[model samples]
Target: MLAIGAAVLFAIAFLINAADMSTNDVFTSTNVMLIGLALLALHVAGIGNGWAGRRRR
Candidate 1:
């Protein structure tokens, strides 16, 4: 559930970046992209941690 929420948030951020890019806001778009990627990485890592812990038990 948490992962899904994070992913949705990331998607929204990505969309914002895309829209900004289309409007020629390169700097802000790039920042948004970076933030989205970071959030996605964290979300995936969190899910992996949860799954791995369950498997180890």
Candidate 2:
């Protein structure tokens, strides 16, 4: 859930940043997008699996 939340928050940030790209710069927008994407990947792969669960042998 935490990861999902982080991913959502980051995505929002990315969207906002993207919208302001013209006022800002390309690097900032690209960095925000990259971070958001990374968080989203972690959310789907880790948090979605229940982070505290045990693994099989």
Candidate 3:
């Protein structure tokens, strides 16, 4: 749930930044958005938060 909220926030930021990039030619915004989407994708696929990189107690 929190992740979704973060994704939404990031998405809005992404859109705004993308618009800015159109005139400024910057990559930071795109990179951040991609990272956010990637994390959300992992979460949705149930592979987030060190799922395979950690052992459950």
- The number of the candidate with the highest TM-score is 3
Candidate 2 residue lDDT tens string, 1-57? 646666666776677776764545644656665766776777667656665767999
lDDT of each: 0.59, 0.64, 0.65
- Model 3: per-residue Cα lDDT over 1-57, one tens digit each: 537755875976678776775434444676667767776777787664453556679
Q: Candidate 1 regions off by >4 Å?
A: 1-27, 47-57
Task: Let me know the TM-score candidate 1 reaches against the reference structure.
Answer: 0.40
Highest lDDT, which number? 3
Residue pairs in clash, model 3: none
> lDDT tens digits, residues 1-57, model 1?
545655665676677766654544554645555665666677666644454434543
Off by over 4 Å in 2: 1-27, 48-57
Candidate 2 local Cα displacement, residue 8, angstroms: 5.6
